[model samples]
Target: MAAFRDPLAGFVPDALVLVALDNALSRGWPDAAVSDLTRDILHASGIADGTVPAPAFAALLGDGRADLVARVRFLRMALGDLALGFDALTGDLPTFMDRAQTFGLFRYDKAMSDTAAARAEVRPWVDYVSALTRLEAAHLVPRLPGNAGPDWLEIGGNSGAFAAAICAARADVRITVSDLPAVCGLGQEMQKGQDRIRFQPRDARKSGWAAELGARDLLLFKSVLHDWPDHHARAFLTEAVACLEPGGRIVICERGPFAAGLADASFLSRLANAVFAPFYRDPSVYEGWLRAAGFAPTRQTVQLDMPFHVIEAVRA
Candidate 1:
């Protein structure tokens, strides 16, 4: 297994890749068959000479010139790299599996039901990812204008991890995390004793969800908007703008366009795009939506290596 020393592990394969890999396997490909095909492709491509580039590799996988078994093997290796990369960063495969199973992105349901069992299964994964996102938030929150005020509202905030991180950084910052009722309950439970952080049940699509909150100085939508397609995303932004206080800010942090770094795109990156094309969008699309919502882009940071973008916009 390759070892990654960076705290964030540079890049882990997107969860979407794992979903595609699992789907292919479930459809009947065997491990031994994939392994044999992988060996054949390596010999045919003359990978030993190291002359084959990423596009060539992508062609081999997608041009239909290669056999189905070979293509499946190629995908498997990419998914394996993601697994190894995540393990290298966190050193906890069992925990990752628990989260992966609960997330169920490959399944038709795509998440557990609202039963107690569902909450129990999903909470740990939410907590784990939230903790990781909190590190990023720590770097980002301080960069916002000091005039933004102490009131913070996080849309789709899960388990209150980001809110907790913000409150920890500045004790007076009050945080309200809006999410589904089950998720809100889990966050409320996790944030007990931290009176500054609160979770409210909300569905972002429902009209007036943001209106219920009155006005907030800073609204956060971390890894949230990308889950929806354009029309819904635009509507959410409009609602978010209405929720903001005059001169308030809305911060969006999400996975940016997959093709931006295609010159050196890893197998995982390509597979992520294949699986999540509908959910991913270029940052310019976000800029347009912000302007449409009557907000002006104030700051934008694209972390090309880590492959995420943070766009901060303020009400005009």
Candidate 2:
């Protein structure tokens, strides 16, 4: 029964063996210490992997009288502390997400039905396009308050996924996805059949956008601000707020802080500098800019796996 519950004991035992090997290699411990820690990590890994039978572990390690127990204890303590200390060195998840958003690693366009061949032609990178689709469907759109039509505008919409999700779910709502010409072109292709969705080539911070995009019930700045500095983010927000109708709302979706997990820090930070260094502002700094632009945040939500944050504000 115990074996059935944790069938992967063999695999886990192997992993613990590897960790022990790596630790031994790094620490240069004496032969005995190396052997002991190796055995413990292998045992623990096996347990975690669900391959090690708990009863077997008890039979082996249960005898507190053995030196093996002491060795296992030392190995666990050393490895756990090492993991925490390394984590500290890597920086936190929020910072990493901010960087990811900036760097375009979160490019979120992995496989557009319209461009699957093109995307597939290139091998996988750490793009976040698929994740974005999920977030738009699950978290970002549902939180939106309006049940109205043709009343939304998306700033920094790269491929119209957000607008597409909105139009797909709520047929009445029309959104103009505004971005630079190249990006708008891609989005235009993506939104081809949907008359309710249109692509406009425009910059968010510029004045002409107001007249071009016109008033909207909701202005969406999805994952754009972190690519900018504070002043620019403020300027963009000011423009967006101006183009909103009275009692209208502006929704900003971004990568939530410290949420991406450990392996992503370097990838995320590098990505941020690439795509968002021009406009990326820290979340706190961006919050201040939003207030300065005369918008008060009414709601903020965090979503997992996709590294997303949705902030809804009303024009004040």
Candidate 3:
């Protein structure tokens, strides 16, 4: 089996989570499936708002792009982690009996979301960026011409996984990866040998990155933009237009379309922290954003047996 981000060591043990399982499996389910069931349980337990009492397990298995034990680990972790509120012994339900809401649950919500405050607080369990290693990272980047020497900028590219992938695939490109300071620190280690790939500290939420970072031949945002509201996303794209030279290219890849949530991003971000991860918007949304930021683009879906959408725009 492929490895995921590693170190789910979030104050809980993998075995301890599995022991709580009380059901049979049918087929591999997506993260959306688990999110819905958990939502139902949360509501049935008397909470109408979509919220989990504690951190949900395997909530991010989908983020890794492959099935980890056919969602068994995710389900079992749910049964184990959030088993305090609901009454586990009643009705058609096989396990949960009460609210099943437990305190002291493993929580990565704070560090993983767009609302994260500082890089210092990020823990091992929140290192979702390395999850890219489990995937063929090369497929995530655009296929540039063999002789094209591109200066690439990867925003929020934690650990420079994508940069390393593309650099291995090409010879003439120099890539700079930017993320939170601490994440950049981690990337510096993961990106030791490749002189072509370097680490630069950047926060996507901040402005003026384009002015400070200078121009690049290509800019890539993989699994990054959807974490923000449309406005911030728009601003980032707008900034990208300035960051790239007049004829540069911008590429954005996300799992699926972002279902634009509540208008208030701060509130939505806070809600997201306590909610069951995220979803997506259509590729057109990104196309529109790209157009608004000044680019004529082409879109393609990654044929990697996963729901990855790639949008590329060249500033003219």
Ranked by TM-score from best down, the candidates are: 1, 3, 2
Q: Comparing 1 and 3 by lDDT, which wins?
A: 1
Residues 1-316, model 1: lDDT tens digits: 1221222112224444334433434444322233444333433433211222235433433533223333343445445544554553246544554454222422313122455765665554465455446446655556555667889899888888778877887866898998776677777777889899987777777889555877898888887787776888888888888888778898888767656656655554464333333366777889888987777886555443235667889867
Best-matching candidate per TM-score: 1
- Per-candidate Cα lDDT values, in order, are 0.60, 0.54, 0.55
For candidate 1, what is the lDDT? 0.60
Pitting candidate 2 against candidate 3, the one with the higher lDDT is 3
> Which regions of candidate 2 are displaced past 4 Å?
1-131, 147-149, 259-284
lDDT tens digits, residue span 77-183, model 3: 34443444234323323233223221122232333433335344442322433543335365554433343237989887877777777887777789998876767
**Residue 259 of model 2: what lDDT?**
35
Specify the highest-lDDT model's number: 1
The TM-scores, one per candidate, come to: 0.63, 0.54, 0.59
Cα shift from native, residue 257, model 3 (Å)? 3.8
